[model samples]
Target: MSERPGLDIKLPNGRHIQYRGIRYHGSPQHIFWFEFLPTLLDHTIREELKKTAELAKSTSVSVEQSVAEVVALLNNLVQRAYIRAVDVDRSLMGDGFTKGEARDVAHNVEGYNKYIVEQSNVYVLEYSSNEEKVNYAIVQEDVLDIKPNFCGIGININALWRKIKGKFLP
Candidate 1:
């Protein structure tokens, strides 16, 4: 007998089939950039990065490293808050999901992160899913203007905040 654990009745050839296994790849994840937060809301992120850097015990911590850790925390926080605010099952994203069937269940920093929504100020978010622990990201943080051009457009922060709050909360 083979090491496999399922019933091996090979008598039925075509109509019936058996799935040996299903692999959940934690590395080299498929990333999707759904949307981005404009520089308007990035003030808090800058302060957060400084705080992250200050908390590091090692003096050799670089800005890139600090930004990565904080961005991961923000995304995780948003996802969790949303899940708690409304039951994931109630949300239309997925009507319902079983343990293994839920594809977006990821909080491990060591896991490959695919859905990256970075605060434009930090502009650097990195993830290492496997043994290859290397930072190979090139972001254009230093532009000639040193600020994002909103294309001469104006915004009301108060109204924006209300819309954002309503979308995420309730």
Candidate 2:
């Protein structure tokens, strides 16, 4: 199969991103734009593990042996919206060709790559040599802000860093 060309677009955040296979569709296209998420999650998880391991090393927590458990925790964080995508969809729809040139009713048009972002609670986790604690905070989006909807302290820090790192690993 040939690789589909992606549409380069900017997120609400200042950072720009690309969505593969976003083309004008006469019908509808179901593209999982976030397919690059797993690899992203992997790198993010490893980094978080290293940090936690270092902290544990200082406190005798032995989190180095808890890779599996930490991984599970990370997965849960993602599922719980610690890490999430920002909402944005672009679409242009109309019936193929209207009978009347000047005035005519258009056909129904819907669907594209849908992105769901959790904009509420942002969770934060800190594992210092002294302590490990998870906390959260709520934030409202600024209407005029083009910056992407981001996860907050209420969200997972690892997840937030993944986005900030901005590498889409395939």
Candidate 3:
């Protein structure tokens, strides 16, 4: 017989203990009460679990393990944001400047990739002027500031970094 993904363990006192295939243990009524209820009132935990199991079996990776792998991948991308900023800076530095045409362009260089993954918590900006452009891209790990001539760009970048990191990291 195939082992059930979940199980019920009964105690000597006739109380039923339910398990969710892992360390999750609780009363059967608490775990499966929604299952026994009417269709309109029932929750979809069973259906969701079935879908998860199907995905895991097809991928040959357990759901728990997949979650860990995904988290690690996200962390790696977060670290790569730094390298991406350097590349953006180099590209901007290579381009010569022309006056009177917006004069300022703050394009997202690294975090654009993160947006594809639905994790656009970081942004890089390229500050340029009419005469010369800065090679070092302003990495707004949280916020970005664009002004014609006024300064405080660094302060705005740091503030934005703090805000974004606070929202996504913790």
Candidate 4:
């Protein structure tokens, strides 16, 4: 099959991103939009992993090897996930992060953690479910100021990652 072109758009966090086969039906709020989230989020999250890896490389901070393992595991969730994209006012989104948007996502979305980050706008919202074989995250900016500008309900059909998640949470 021939590859399709993606919609080149700017994320609210000042990052340029692309979405393939993304049809903006009624402002992109259609249920079908959820079908394209893995592509969008997979790119966004890997970019974030690059940033974190770079920070460790450039700065004095040291990232433990176990940390890399956790990242790898989360990356795996990118494929095994089922995402529920949040519906926000289009005007409120675009080119920057806001604390209110972050809070709104945490409070309004079930199971995701509420994060109050003083130094950064980014945080991972891990979803807790009763299912024994799955894990999920509400990824935003994929942690690049991981804005509330875009967040989702991503469910991973895996029994692992539950124990590893505790290693990074503050």
TM-score of 3: 0.22
TM-score of each: 0.28, 0.30, 0.22, 0.26
- Put down candidate 2 lDDT per residue, 4-101, tens digits, no spaces: 77666543334455556644343222222333333344445556666655666566763424443555566465553311321122222334443212
Model 4 shows how many backbone clashes?
Answer: 2
Winner by lDDT: 1
Q: How well is each residue in 1-170 modelled by candidate 1, as lDDT tens digits?
A: 67665322222122222333433222111111111111212334455655664554245455456656777776665555434423432332333453323333334322212323333233433222222123333223222222233877666565566679989988
TM-score of decoy 4: 0.26
Best by TM-score: 2
Q: Residue 91: error of model 2 in Å?
A: 10
Angstrom error at residue 90, model 4 = 14
| Runs in model 3 lying further than 4 Å from the true structure | 1-60, 94-170
After TM-score superposition, the amount by which residue 26's alpha carbon in candidate 1 deviates from its true location, in angstroms, is: 42
Ranking by TM-score: 2, 1, 4, 3
Model 1 gets an lDDT of 0.39
Q: Per-model C-alpha lDDT, please? A: 0.39, 0.38, 0.37, 0.38
Alpha-carbon runs more than 4 Å astray in model 4: 1-31, 65-170
lDDT, candidate 4, 1-170, per-residue tens? 98788666665345654557754444454422333443455455555555654465455343333235545555444423422233333322433364112213332222211111210122221111223113222331132222232367444423234445756755
